[model samples]
Target: MASPPCSAASNFDCGLEIKTRSVEQTLIPLVSQITTLINHKDRLKKTEKTLRAIQKVGQAVGVAVGRFVAVGEAIALENEELREEMGHACFEARRSGTAIAQLTDVCGVEQSAGVDRCTVFSDKMAMVKAARMLLSSVTKVLVLADRIVIKQITSSRSRVLVTLEQLERVSTFQEFVQIFSQFGNEMVEFAHLTGDRQNDLKDEKKRARMAAARAVLEKCTMMLLTASKTCLRHPDCESARINKDGVFQRMRLALEQVIEIVTDARPGAEPKALPISIYNGIQDFKARVEALRDCVYCVPCESLAVQLEALVEQTEDFTDSAYTSHEQRENVLQLCHATRQDTHNLVATFSQDQQSIKAREVSEAMELAILKTSHSVSELRRELHNVAVGRASELLKIHSDHAILQALKTAGEDGNLEKVADLARTLTEQREQLVETCRLLCHISGTEPLEITCIHAEETFHVIGPQIISAAQTFALHPNSKIARENLDVFCESWESQLGDMAVLLKEINDVFEGRRGDKRAYLSLPRPGKHSANLKTVKATKLDAEELSTIAKLGLELRLVTSDVDSELERWEDQNHDLARQCGSMARVVCSMALFTRGEGVLKTTLDLFHQAELLSEQGLQLCSLLQDFSTQLLDEERVLMVSEMEKLAVSCQQLQACAKTPVQGKSATFQKVDSCIQHTKGIMTVVASLLPLWHKLIRQCQSEHSSQASPQHWPDTQLSPPLKEDTLNGKGSNGFGVKSLEQHMASLTFLESK
Candidate 1:
């Protein structure tokens, strides 16, 4: 019960845990193959089949090990700090793979059936040694690659700090503008880097802590921009200075927290990881239970029983929760009972194996019990997945319509305190539902990252509910105050943003369950545009009204759905690693993040970041449109015209957005008009994307079908074509594609507005 004697097999004793799921799971098949190679004679009689079996598994192992080392070597080239160690590990892996190949040669034995039973079995020792070496090397490589990831994050954080200091010390508006632009670029880089790291981390609490730190930096960034400008405008004002100082302080603290998490720099800073769920407990229990075959005398069967009981107790989380459906509760109970029975049978077989005649039949019986227990555990996990995914889906739909927020807004504006109070109660009830759902989700999310997202959602709802109430009180008290309404709108958007985040997280969880997850780049790719931060002293962005925010939120939701649709089509491509898929997937992620950013509580922090994202999106869109234009006659001319026209609209809108972001306007009316124009432009861009996404997907599928099966694509049946021929430069692979001037037109995003 104390511990399983520092198990080299369990502890993984490599000084690192593989936090990435792909790296961890990659070892499973190799392990199984090795086990088969060493124990083949036990299962198969000596013959030509046995020789072929050895050849088959040996070649597979060598090739797998070789490819695994290649990945490690590539990582080494990227991270100089880990290069030597990673290179050494990769070398060892390749050497061991060669050793495995030689050990299982069996070529001379193939020609003769009776090459001495001793010769056939003699090299098993060397084979085991080579397999161990190969496995160890592969693990070392994975761990080293993981270290490189951490190093990249630490290096990114250092860059942000350097810019942070410059931004804090700048005295002139021009100096601040230049430094903040660099700072924005750095922060975006840091955001993208840390976001990937955050998702890759296996520790749920660490992910949550990282999320919290990043959230602080994101909001403080927007605050920092305004606070610094205010201080520069009123050099003698203490409040402005204090506000600027506070933003700087929070930014630094968030920066520190992020690094501390990745590096565990501070003593005692490592938080306890999330409590091990029933799924993990069952895995450990089964491992210990299975160990009885070899180490029956050394193992304590009592501990196995205790661990099973603990797993069963953990299931009480699902069974006892009021939110759980009766059927799910019953199913969980049944699985728990089945697992207990299977475990009991396995332990009984273990006892019989120890006391009886050490017969092959008894050994076989114990194996059967182990397999059944494992199956029971698998069933339990599936049921848990269903429960979690189902509950999450229901909660998402229930919380989808933000009618309560709209009602609260209207009531506040109307000075109806009773209506506002009633809506607040309804919101409170909704918050409780979300919080409980989060707790249930954490138990069955199946991965640390998702569990963290669930916890974040819960906390968002918990923190923002009271803020919404407080803001509503202020709005009702001063119905005429624009600031009060804005405050309330901010809280409402925060709630909506959490909903949007939860939707994405749900899809991710489902994707993991279905085994459709791609590489790390696809995990969080932005490839965002970096722009000069402008001094906007004379051009305060006119705040979006309720109608505008509503439109933005609706657009956000639509973009998210379309991006999901694009992801599905991308998955259907024959070549998973195709450049076109990667490019489109990157654009999809940017759009997805843009969707969340538009929803208001996302990582973009300010309108400036939003404008920057929009320009980058149009740039990607034009590139995509060009690619489409170059495609064969699969696309009809009119459809081509539509795609090209929409892209042009997106481009022009980005152009207008860039101008609005840069130029200073004199009147509030002028500022409002300019801001409205920007919004309308963004709407046009969103509309283009929403309509074009399906066409792009259809075209890709058509191209794919043509390549493999030579099937004609589904074409548009309409003959009434729109007029064409404004430009012929929309070719996908043309050197003379949409020129650099258009790129320049959008490069002045968030400009340093200097009055001439």
Candidate 2:
């Protein structure tokens, strides 16, 4: 700074130049520096403009990039949501794009390049459409699954209620088992459908409900199975208690499971207890089961036991009576059947136990009692049947006796004395047989023989006694002279003989009936008698007491009146026979005298009278022959044949005598011959008649002997006359005046008598 001041005076001139030069140098540098500064300022202004533009461009690019990034993130998030919703449905929709590629082939697109390019845009479009369709389908599936779950839960609950009701109503072991088994099957099916996790359901609440329903069903099924097992093991009242307990436990478990499921479905919620109604229902069922068990143990057994004991006492008391009525017997049978039914019920109750020793013993005892009682009833029925049959037989015998007595009365009224005698003999034989039968029946049945004999005797007397007396009176009073008193005498003799025999037979039967033998047991144990032994013992032991003998004597006295009447009628018949014989002899004498006389008016009148008398005598002889013929027919012996022949000869002789009397004499010799023939024929007729009497008597005795040999009773009527004899009698053609066969011997006899 000092040098610049010195240069300012000497330096004014020198400093001026130095200043100028310094100015030049400084100006040049300033100018140069100014130019550089100007250029730097312009460049800095351009750089500032460029920086503003760059800033604006950077802000626009940043905004556009930010929008693109936001769109990409939104698209990615949408794709993730679609994947979660669609599942397999989206894949199925994408597979549909292959169809569009196939359609491009129809447009002439080649398989190499055009085919690959043709479906590119279409494939992307199809993928988006498929995604939307998959979402819709998934939404529908979730709705259907929720509905199914709700329905299944409701149905399961209803099924459980029905099963419980059925179980409560079950009466028998088989019924309980069947119901339990059905419930078990239903539970298994429900578990199979609900427990399956393969189905892709979206509703969380519905799935939880289905799970709870399945668990409850399973628990109920298990409880039912346990009850059935207990019943099978012990089929008694005690088993019912066990079954009820099991059901209660199952109900509790099922309720617990449902509560747990409900709590799980509702997050942050408490589990509630079962409803009051459901709890009350379970307790009610338990009480009902207990009541049924008590009734089974007490009611039926006690009532049945009391009834059976009463029936036993009644049956024992009934045995003391002498006779049991039909109503009483029927009541006993009903009691037995009721007792057996009660035993059967007891057996059914204890069937499951293998060691019911006391029950089996009681059943065996009841069976034995039933068998013994049945046998006793059967025996009583058999005895009653035998008695009924015997009574029927006695009635038949009485009818037969009445018929025979009627026949005897008819024959007597008709003046058929020989028929009357035959009927009397038949009646006697029948009575004897009846008495023998009564004796045999008494012996077999252990009845009173005297009682049976008395009944038979009473019947015989009532039926036959009056008939015999009436027949005898009718015969005696008959106006027919032809039925000579001699024939009646013979008939009375025959009746007397028959009646005597019947009386003897009845007495013998009574004696046998009264005789004492051994006890029934001893008699049955003895060996059976042979046929010969039986025949030999036909006369029974007669050890009757005084009273018995007196009774028999009284019965015998009843026949005495009949015998006395027969004798008196026989005496009257003998007188009548003598008168008839005298009248016949007078007629024969008159006929012989007429043959000796001339053929004048007076002689003719006498001959006519004699002829009328001969006719009367012939009619009487014919009546006698008819009676003898009846007796002969009854005899059925060789003597019967002889008697019949003789009677026919006598009838023929009578006819010859009438013919000779009726014929006119041609010469003196002829007239004498006729008279002699007439006399001889008459005598021949008388001889034949006399001969027939003895033959008739012999035949009657033969008939009686034949009837006595037969021991069995006559249960049916005898055969009527033979067909040939009936035909001959009805034809009205006379054979030797006998109304039967004509004999050549009779004609020869007539010729011989004429020749003599």
Stretches of candidate 1 off by over 4 Å are 1-216, 219-254, 267-269, 290-298, 359-368, 514-756
Q: Return the lDDT, model 1, position 225.
A: 51
RMSD of 1: 19.7
TM-score of each: 0.47, 0.18
Instruction: Kindly list the per-residue Cα lDDT of model 2 for residues 671-739, writing each as its tens digit.
Output: 334534544555456545433432333344455556765642232122222232221221112232331
> Residue 276 CA error for candidate 2 (Å)?
30
- Worst 10-residue lDDT window for candidate 1 reads 725-734
Q: CA lDDT of each candidate? A: 0.63, 0.37
Model 1, 113-221: lDDT tens digits are 5655333255566677777778778888877767767787888889989988887887765566556656766666677677667766656567667876776565454
How far is 103's C-alpha from truth in model 1 (Å)?
Answer: 29
